[model samples]
Target chain A: MSTSLDDRLLALIDGGDDAEAIQQLQTDPAARQRYLDLVALQIMLHEKLEGDAAVVTPEQEAERLKFRALVWAGALAAMIALAVTAWFALTASDVNHKPVSVSHSIAMISDLSPDARFADATAMMNLGSELMAGPIHLTAGRAQVVFHSGTVVDLTGPCEFEMTGVNQASLKLGRLEAYVPPDAHGFTVQTPAGVKVVDLGTAYVLHVRQDDVSDVRVTEGRVLIQTDQEQRELAADEAARWRISPSGLASLEVTRTTARQVLIDFRGEASQGVNASERYNVFDPVGAWRFTSAFEGTRLFSNLHDVDGKPTGISLTSRMATTMAAGIAGELFVNPVDGFEYNATTDGVFIKGDPDQHHVIFHFDGLEPGGKYAFTFAVGLEANNQVAPKIALGASTQTLAPHDKTRVIAFDDIIADAQGRIDCTVTPASPGVCFITALRISYQALQPTQERMNP
Target chain B: MAGPREPEQFVQHLTAHQTRLRAFIHALMADWHRAEDVLQETNAVLWRKADQFEPGTNFHAWAFAIAHNQVRLARLRSARDRHHFDETLADQLASEAIEQFADLDHRRQALAICFDKLPKKQRELLARRYTANEPVTTIAKSLRRPAGSIRQTLYRIRTALADCIGRSMSREAGQ
Candidate 1:
């Protein structure tokens, strides 16, 4: 009675005095005025309380309700933030140049409709319809495929192969280099000779030619090669050829071989786990371009540099890159085919490539028309002081720098213009460590896209 | 009863109940977004647990129960840290008045539209005095204003909004 008319009515309803409710309803003028208006609410609340017996005082109910409201609000914001952070973290990991492992087999098919039954000995790649026994199989595409388990393969325009029987596989016509895992049960590439490759616990490449020549090269670890008639264990920086016609194995100097070099660097503190909280400033200090990662699952630092100690004119990508390299603990962060830029502290470099493919690209943009460039790549030597020389893929010889204690390699000078993309590859003489950090490249005139037609 | 009504029957029932339930939740939560979330969660729960409910037996009651629980849960989740709000009980009374009118879905919609059209200052006073459960003294203390001034302001706002609601209803009816 000391309350408002509304409160009193509510109190009556709460108390469950129905007989008194009707009498109280009849006497109060305000209650009579809103009699019909209160009917539905009365029925609903009455049923809600009496039917379920979940009756509660208003204070207690309000306290419980406010708690729920706050929790819902916080949870919603947290979920969105986590999603964004996860996306950027996945991308930053790729920029720092970490290796990726083959968590799933990427199967790609060359011809969606094919007549030939690719033989069991065909080297199946992550790029073709070889039907890999894993989560992701690249079904149809001519891709330089990299698996999460540090396996890189260049599946040509058409081929098929399967990963049958554990690590042992049968290749039809593809080329591949598998960073043999320590746990791998000696993967056998069954050619006509049934060569069993013992796990050297390192990275090696294998290629099958049209004339039945199986070219095997060891990049990092030692590889044991076997034929129906002969067996050989080749160390890193060595290669051997097995001819199907002669049915014999011949050891060859790896210097006579051809391959490409991929140079990448990181610019900031690498992501701790799967996400990054800080944004690193990574940019191609030389050109007008876009930034991209090499592949999915590969981790990279926030910085990358070309052989010419200059910004590659490419920033760290915002996508996960694939991991592919031999014995590399993590995944290699591959740059995208485009460009981007930002600012951050710089980290070291990561070198990764597909073993079978002979072409490594020195990806650069924003170059001058005629600029002098010089660079140095540090080389790590084995016990014998033998330098790991990479095969210069496109143009080989140039002026060498003063060799204080090592080889100062160089490249041919060329004019750069806007008419084409300035991309080249430098092959290493040996395989163990073919990378240089402190490099120099001079800048010259820039040919804009519009100037091409007018000039 | 037989397989708990086909998908088609369920869809039809949902279409019929969705608007009504939405309006009901909107009134209770006073937050459109929260209402929508509760509606979605309620609908999903209703679908999964539809088998437990007998067919043709007070569908609204069953649905309302689910919605009520969802609202309670949502409120608890949002206000876990703040056990009490400093709005007047009169504010709660005003919101309660609207809630009383909320059962009529059409009237509730019309009233909500009119409510939003009111000035922000007036709406705040109304919400504080009527919708929220704070006592007048508590509201005055929180606002750092005199209780008499707040009461006078509230009286003026109520009279104006009553007139606003009446005009808004007539306009909608004419339209």
Candidate 2:
């Protein structure tokens, strides 16, 4: 192995892939030893650095220093257990045998968005604070309520929510998203008019507006929504909507919509593909772009603007390595939305099929470092079952099929790369058929959602 | 089958090898936080299988076998985002890592002695990257340097640390 073994191993530890370095470690004896040495060094750094994160005050640091040798050898496990034994076994043998305070709190606050406001308190709830079953009203802000059973319910208020059980909750107003692990099976959510959404284990989103309407979209797994009129099972990517009119009657509608679209609709954003004749009515966009034919090889500005309607400095370059042989125009297509009749995308950048040609690549730059973002885009697939198209974002890849003729794909909580770069590639099943129709990106904070916090 | 061992003996063996078992998992999986969770799980299994451990046998080796199985099961259950080696590659690395991490404590001691000698700025950078689990690209952006340069700088510090550790270990062995 070479001297750059250090760099290679460093990169690998940092989540970079190098087949050659891995191969060397497998075949070379000296390299293997060096790699192991590096691993040991990493273990020490992790142990100490993480210990620093845990021991906060000077007293805690002093306590750690008293048994620093044990701490160095990953002794936290043995020491914490020993400490409990030392304190309880010797002093309180009576209760040590078996007696303790019972906790009535069934859930904990996992995350709260920056602007999250609870109706009980006009400020943020501390992350990991335990909650007892009662009403949870949020005047504004988004919060993730995590049940001890491993289910997480994300709520966006002005929402009137009541925690009825460890596995049950009522969404009387605003929006609720439930992410249930298989162990958290039978998790249920109730809406107004006594409609119950019993989840069989899925990641789903729901919206309840003030106008007596509640919409639920199942993004990954199946969702069971039981209404007064009917009980329906919504499969992946299917949506269920309940509307109650002032006549005090409830109505149900089953439709097809992505989680992204339902969220957009709930926010009262302009509907995408709602009117074929009316131009540019899109879902909520921090940035929106259309690959006009005139936008060939030239950089075009996005319709993204601030509250004052100034540009947000987000744009797209229409250079796809293989530019459509000069003077070729964008292609127009009809995008079928289950309930909307007049849904179509105007002219989009069309690519001529070349089997060996590289798929379309777009590098989104000039983003704030460490920001979490979600983006949704539309693709026009000409055939129902030609081949599955692949989309690669960073190192993660997903193969998806068109929903009818047009597919709107959205990915959430994608952490921007160190260079603040988001590279997207759309690979067509057939060479000449793939078309880029539209795309939008939104910024979101992930610390509230992604980071694991203990109270 | 589970066999018989003293509870104190089992706890002693398990805790002593916690750090090494962690290193073995890191060899197969790239995510450090996930590795810690696997280590905890492995410790639980080791406790349950305490009686299965034959007396006079090498405890680290036995513990490594159980830890390897836990890592295998975990990777199989992981969701998208967490990274791991394939089954075949992980198996190969597991054996090698189990063998290599036997003397891990000594290497770790040497690493500490050498790591403390690094400049304050370099140490802080390392803490930011590994402790805070920040990415090199973000660090690069903050430093106003190219991401490649930040990576190279890290590589140099790590290489120097490794060299110092190797020499320290050799000096102690000679004495």
Strongest candidate by lDDT: 2
| CA lDDT of each prediction against the hidden true structure | 0.41, 0.61
| DockQ score of the complex predicted as candidate 2 | 0.16
Tell me how candidate 2 scores on lDDT. 0.61
What is the TM-score, restricted to chain A, for candidate 1?
0.31
lDDT digits (tens) for residues A1-455 of candidate 1: 22344443443332323444445554554553343233333333222222333445585456445534533433433443344345334432221133323443332322221212323334453113334443222233334433223344443323444454334555655455465555442545565456556555777767766666667767667777665555667665456666665634443222211212224323212111111212222222221111123323222223344322434443222222221221111111111111111011111122333223322345444443334332333332222223233523134433223222223344534445453224444333433223222222323222211111111
True contacts kept of 1: 0.00
- Model 2 lDDT tens row, A1-455: 35677788877876678888888766777776777778777777767675767435564355335334433323433443454335334433222123222446666676665566877773336665667677789886667787666677877768888877767788888888788888777788888787888887798888889988778878668788776655778766567777887664467767652112211110111112323222233333222222223334544334334222334454444456553321111212322321222233322333443444645566666565776777665554432223333567766776555343225666787777787767776565544345544554656541211222121
Clashes of 2: 6
